[model samples]
Target: MNTINTHYRLSHQIQDEAFILSQAAKCNLYLSISQKSIRLAVMDTERNKFVVLEDYELITVFTPMQVAEQLRLIAQENPLLQEQKWNTIRLAISNIHFTLVPETLYDPAHQHDYLRLHSDLNPLQDVVLAYRHNSLEAINIFSLDASTYQALEALFPERQLQFVHQTSTLIRSVLHLAPRTNLRSMYVFVERNYVTLLVVGPSGLEFCNIFHYLSPEDFIYYIIFVMQEQKMNPEQETIMVWGDITHDSSLFNILQKYIRQIKLGKKPSDLEYSYKFHDMFEHRYFELYSLHLCE
Candidate 1:
């Protein structure tokens, strides 16, 4: 197997040592070896606004072309990125990571099935850590299990893949390894086997949660429990729900009551990124969380 080392430097020394300890225990946390730099940006389709994040620093405005140009420059500098020849790359623009697959891919009626490989911070682990820190800043890494991995290969002989990272610290590190305004807080949620990611900052937060076997009720219960444990008032926080579960008006209504504000988090213009290079996914989820959260 091939491995890539990416490092990030932050302006602010994470002051919550207890929180860091908690995260390390729950999620497998490790320091990166290579201090690589990258730039990321996202567009708020509804507000007609653009937000660019570099090395944890935030840039007020950026066009789609500008984002593309930045990626091109990174690819030029990094040999591995240049090898991918990817049309686009997906980035969190915040300090979190998630997996995004076409909605159609999950349809049971669909005959083809292919496994998508993702590398980023682990969500379950990150949530545990973030809760301990009393901060939403976190990252996520995703990959398929052995059984699912094999099943996907049988379903789709041809691979349908995209590489993206949605971690807050990693995104900031990529920008310049220094803190920035655009890169804000991030949260991770998972249900069934799929991962849902949420990122918030000056431009407002976006949410995307997906699950196959778990019901929306279960997902909400977890959210409520986590918030309660962390002493977070859900009633004061804005929440946006997405995916098949949100289709149910009844469920959506219930969520709206519990959350400060609720909306469906989807923006077409937000789809832009350099789809190459996988992230590290070797650490244990619980270990990472415990190390980052628990004192």
Candidate 2:
């Protein structure tokens, strides 16, 4: 049997942190961090082997001593093999911010507060939580203009406050995925009832238009008009869709008649086949389309 050694590096320390760093032997690790948990993986350098070793949760009362003890136990249980050597445990701390709902009063029903906080574009909104990712810690807050801050303050006059700017790598990744110009157009029809227009290319994906309650003719016209605006020929392009629309008679027939080529998106195997509820239409369509294109 062959043995491999891996090291773990931690930074952005906070009271509550979630992150993962894997592939340590060759000095590269896959890092994933969020407010609620952290995950890390260690990969074998010689054989392209890897395993996740850290997936831990942090709490408000957690202390450095407690964390050190936890790491010690992990090292003992997963003792380094002879051929594989582990050394120089690296750690850092950082803070992460999560949105809080005053109305919910820390109840389970408000569990989605963190997701909503990250999604809100309003700067005045404030959240409480100093999540440590690695070795750095700071209070997470919303940076808002004076007017927005005043408006939000009025809404929750007596609530405790902490503010931190949004600066998570995950957030940055999402921003990078925003649409760039390469492909002319992308369209998603959901179960024949709704339509979403996406502008896609090398840059990424962007939402152009979302249409519901429109007739199939009008929707087609709208898409064609958009293509013209973007200086592209509609006849040369393709439209993609996903969802359960097996029973929609009129919409299905219209799609067959007017669209040059329609495709359904499939989930990428690399993505673990997990679908976001809000992204079901776009992801499914894109996945299916990608599968067919690759073939």
Candidate 3:
């Protein structure tokens, strides 16, 4: 069951028959939070399979308080989210104000300083956080609205929450899924109005950035521009795509017009999914699923 209100709209809800509310303590809860949307995913740790998934498309939520209020409304409706305790609670924040810094250069004391270079973060309004990438030997520094962060804290007051940047989760999952070779490969995560372009190399992530587009032309332009900057041949190098796009989408059609090889990415191979998810697009909710890979 789902509902659509003035503040937010429920877009997808999938659950396995085996999911039991009484056994929620044995499951892990993951949430992907942003101003545009909030997604909830539940994984049964004992079986290592995802049992529940929900996506809410937020509307006109531009301020921190607005986003926080929307989250409260969602929690009120989602029974799964109403559960306070779980095996683990992971929340990923999505925003453009994030910068990747090498682990060697990262200083926890100056995390805010690092992010300041990329965005104008207000000390009173924004909270700076960092997620370390152990495998990639890098750190992702990002900002979250202080009020929104506090709202999450208040909601799960007793539960220990693990916060991570959306890009960090994407990077972690892509590395594990990308082939280990010297050849550079590009992986794209497409969302409502933005696309995250990542180029993974043999050793680690070569390039990663988010681009906002107003049109299909802007979307393909960024993709092609990044490929050119990386010196990847569009004819030879293949791009694997995931997220809220379809094969018939104008974004995909334009992508096909320029790039010779484009492949739709599959769900993480190491993880299992419930049969309820079989009918859904495998590429969608990738970052939400990748939360399992986040530390």
Candidate 4:
């Protein structure tokens, strides 16, 4: 063993005064796993409030297997993860390999086929999964690393755990926040290596896709390309952004240079957060907070 390498760091941790290990059975534990971080939020479902939040940033992990190892290491010491019972448990895996198909055309048996149309799937390493967005009336077909999936399943044996793609949570949160106006609104969620962009029209979600970029130039290029393709006006339409970005960061600066309307996204408003959470940026951890909306 490599001693876990000090490869991960706890970036943010807040627990409400009401959070008690014994009361976990009345809370919902939400976990969001991505390439760079693992975040968990404990929502007191009985009170409709969030009581605990933790974000761990992985420093040395580059592969899913490595991430899984870090997860195992963290679970050993994290009391929340050690707890076996919660009102519900939801795990959202974030990645670029996912496709959203309209519910009317979705077939459970062809989940792989739906995802294959967008990315190549490796049967040995990837496990195909689908999440139904009842409100959106769409099905998100995605793949999770087989090893990580099994690790999570083994962690909470006999308990029902719902697994969903991170995009599904993002979509649910965005659609709920989207205004019922005729103008198309663009939303972007930034990660270490990629960005997930979603366009919401008067009716519903009009466009959703992910783009990988290497530099600030590449990042702005994708945003502009999506605007032109969607016939959105860069000078007029506003774009709301969330995740891994700061107001003075190069990414945000570039976005401002090209798009006239740029605003940082807000935290999910459907649920309340503990007073301890007031210090953290509202825009950060949008997906982790959105997991509460997942059903």
Candidate 5:
């Protein structure tokens, strides 16, 4: 039994009428697809803000083929998706197969070797290899599951979909919204069974990685261990967290006990949104919203 969580047309309710395709403004589509969920959002180019947003979860396990079919069907019937020319389309993958390497030493020709070292996937698994130039020094190289990549490709063929590590978007969100942060701080993005930790220091991205967890205990342990290992002073260092979590939740409680400064992340200061997004968590879609700002 697959479980789907949906909140549709929050924007249309605020805008009075639907964002019809005939409107001359260009729009963008952002998708955050993972092993367990698919999130889609639309941002009106003229308005420089998102207008339509939706997400779905799979309670039951499915093969990659099943999900690709589901996403295809959703696009076929979506009205906001009808005729607008998309300026940019982005997909962020949460798979652990991704690894970051130094840009100066990276060979555009050797992506396969780097990807294989980090992921156990067969080199010939019909996967598409790609990397995002994350920063002046860091680049994320990873594998996109063949079926999922092709499904997204077939859905929107007019413009090529830009892919990046899910954590990469988290980095983009922080840099855009909170560049002037604590001298040494950490950003935590929590999902159902996964966690992404990003450490930013004065220089640049200090550390970034994704980890899977089974319980709240396991979750806080990893966060604390990383901070300790980094020699971050719990008294002075801050941790800004977002996504699928709550302040009263066990995860938050555990984190608060160990870290002196724990706060929730906010929407990127660079973008605006309709009042429709007011009811939504300010941090829920940071990655999707930041995708528009991704180069």
Candidate 6:
């Protein structure tokens, strides 16, 4: 429940009084969930743009109840969050499992495959099941803790809450942001214990998956394995990375040895941000910011 990072952008000229909390009514509210913290953003439909509002990073993992309470406490502390109505979209990333089914063979009734694939790693006793259709890629069938879903729902009982429970939010975020070119590219989003690998070929999304690891050894192993299994030449295909990692990290060092091209991902260029975002790292919030673009 401890916040390790907080950033707010409000113009001194207008201040908080002019920009009322209810302004969120016109903006698309996005929340990205994780074990360590929750990230939020607001997109103004009128302006067809978005701004990175705030992020809450916890000091330690909190239970589902504690997570819900922390959300309440944080909202109470912010004037903008006091609004009674906000069009909200919650994107759960942590403790989520997803599998892709080719559209040609996709069937809505087969959603149980999502829960079945990862049942060993994540039990689905009280988990909510959902799916999203990717026109260009494939159907993403996914699952998340039902209690966590309830926790989020409890936060905004009065507002319209549409859940963006993508099986791989990081990959979907990168999918919309990354370029669509002929060059085979792999977008890697590294979290503390998980890494999302999305490979985009000239045609479309060739491969997209998430792998869990405990050490740098395990991280690189999975990366290399994906490349090898997909027949992507680590020496030629480009790899762009974002999230809780740096170029100096051991993971990056290992990746550099096998992969020749490595680029750092930046915030999605489509969104407009305030001057406050100018000082933050461009690579930090790809997934959270992507929540605004999630369908």
Could you tell me every candidate's TM-score relative to the true structure?
0.31, 0.32, 0.96, 0.97, 0.88, 0.82
Better of 1 and 5 by lDDT: 5
Tens-place lDDT per residue, model 3, 148-238, is 8998888888987899999998999999888888888999999888999999887778999999998999999999999999999888888
Ranking by lDDT: 4, 3, 5, 6, 2, 1
lDDT tens readout by residue for model 2, 102-186 = 3323444444454455544333433333322221122222223343234323333553322222232222222234345556556
- Model 6, residue 163: displacement in angstroms? 1.8
In candidate 2, what residue range of length 10 has the lowest lDDT sum? 286-295
Best-performing candidate as measured by TM-score: 4
User: Per-residue lDDT of 65-92 in model 6, one digit per residue for the tens?
Assistant: 4555566666768655566566555555
Root-mean-square deviation of Cα positions for candidate 5 versus the true structure, in angstroms: 3.8
Candidate 2 residue spans exceeding 4 A from truth: 1-182, 191-193, 273-295
Model 6 lDDT, full chain set:
0.67
Worst 10-residue lDDT window for candidate 1 reads 27-36
| lDDT scores in order | 0.32, 0.37, 0.90, 0.90, 0.73, 0.67
- In model 3, which range of ten residues has the least summed lDDT? 1-10
Predict model 1's lDDT versus the native. 0.32
lDDT of 5 by residue, 1-295 (tens): 6454332222222331457556524777777877677787777888887777777664453566666766665666676445446666777876778888888878878887877777777655546456555554667777777777788777767766688778777877776655664587788999988898988877767888888899988898788888888888777887898888886788888888888988888887867787788887776777777777777
On residues 132-210, what C-alpha lDDT tens digit does candidate 1 reach at each position? 1113232233332222223222333343322223233322222221124654433443322343444445444333333
Worst 10 residues of 4 by lDDT: 1-10
TM-score of 3: 0.96
